[model samples]
Target: RHQGFFRLDPHVDPISDGGNVFILGFCSPTVMSLTPVGGAMGSLMNQRAVSTKSWAAKEDIDVLMEPRTLCHLHGDARQLLNHGIRMGVDAAQLKKQGVNVPDNASLYDWWGGMTSPVQRSPMRLSVVLAFADVDEIF
Candidate 1:
C-alpha cells in the first residue's frame, strides 16, 4: 500500500513556511490496488466545518497508480488532496456489505480491478521526495 502526507503552514509547523511545495511519489511493482482514502484537515468553500475530504471523493477516475508510475502534486492539489491505499477488503465482509463479488474475481480484484486472489502481489513499497523553495536553510 502507498500513502502520502502534506504537513505545512508556518503557524502549525515551524519547519515549514507553507511556501511553494511539491511531492514526487514513486510506486513499486508490487502495487496492485491504489485506493484513495481521503480525509484532509481543511475547510472547503461554502462548507462550514473543517471535515475530512479528498479529490477522489468527488471524481470517479479509475486510473490506477501502476508500477513505476510517478505521481506529482503541487500547490492546491498538494494541500487539498489526501491520498492513501486502502486496506484489503475481505471476501465475506464485501458480501455482507451487499457488494457484488464476481465469481472469478477476488475481493481485492473486485474493488481494485488490478489483480486476482492467487495473483495478488506483495505490499507496495514507495519513496517520497519532497521539495520546498527557500532562500536559506538555517
Candidate 2:
C-alpha cells in the first residue's frame, strides 16, 4: 500500500542511523500545544553531527546519518514545490465554507518519507524540517 510513496538511492553521503524518533503528545483537543521541547530535540540531534568524539566509538557516524538522508530522498527534494499545491487546493475547498487560512500562515512540511526497500540500502534519514501555524495543524 505504501508503494510509489518513496525512492531510495545510496550514492548519497553523510548517512547515519542515529535513531528513529517518534513523539506523541496528548492535548485537550481544544488548546494547541507548541512546546520548545521539539526544538531542543532537534538541536540535540544536530549536535550529534558535530560531537564526533562522543558516540563515535559506539556507532559509525556514517551509519548514524542514514535514516535522515534516506527520508529526504523519499520526497523532501520536491517538498518546497509540491507542498503548496496540496495545501492550496485544500484551503480553497475550505474557504468555500468560510474557513480561510491566515494569509501569513500556511501549511508546511513536517515529515513524510518511505524507508529503503532494498536490503542493502544503508540506514539513513532523508530529511527533516519543522513547521508551525494552522495550515500545518489541520
Candidate 3:
C-alpha cells in the first residue's frame, strides 16, 4: 500500500459487515514499511461508526496490527468500525511528509537488518478471507 492509499468498509446492518473478515498476511521477502494500518476500533472516541451515513463524534483511529499478522473482525468490530489500512502509512514517505512516525511503524528501526533484495522491494501480500457460508470452507 502507498502512503496515500486507504480504505474503510461502510457496512452497517444486522449480521452484516459480510458476516466476518479474516486477513492472513504473507511475504516471501518482507519489508519493514509494508505493514497494513488497520482500524479495528468499535467506535471513534465515543461514538459508533456503524452506517455509512452515520458520522462519528470523533474520527480517531483506535488500533494498528503488525506485519505477518492474522486479524479477525466480527460483530461490532466488523459492523461498527472502519477497519483497514489508514492513510500516510508509508514509513519512508512519513519522514518526507514531516508526519511523526506512527507507533505501529516499529519496523523502521529494523530497516538496517533487511536483506539487499527485500530492502529495495515494496510489496504487500496477504490472503483476506470473508465468511460467506460453511460450504465455502469446503
lDDT top scorer: 3
- List residue ranges in candidate 2 displaced over 4 A: 1-90, 108-138
Q: What's the true lDDT of residue 42 in model 1?
A: 28
Question: Which stretches in model 1 have alpha-carbon errors above 4 Å?
Answer: 1-63, 92-120, 133-138
RMSD of each: 9.2, 20.6, 10.8
Q: Tens digits of per-residue lDDT for model 1 on 1-138?
A: 422211111111122534333323243332222212243322332221111121234441223445566665445444543433333344554555566555433324222332222112334455555556564443
lDDT minimum window of 10 residues, candidate 3: 112-121
Which tens-of-lDDT digit does each residue in 59-117 have in candidate 3? 53333334567767665565555543322223544444454554443222112221211
Clashes of 1: 1
In model 3, what is the error at residue 8, expressed in angstroms? 7.2
| TM-score (C-alpha, index-matched) for candidate 2 | 0.15
The Cα local distance difference test for each model comes to 0.34, 0.21, 0.38
**TM-scores of the candidates in the order shown:** 0.42, 0.15, 0.41
- Candidate ordering by TM-score (highest first): 1, 3, 2
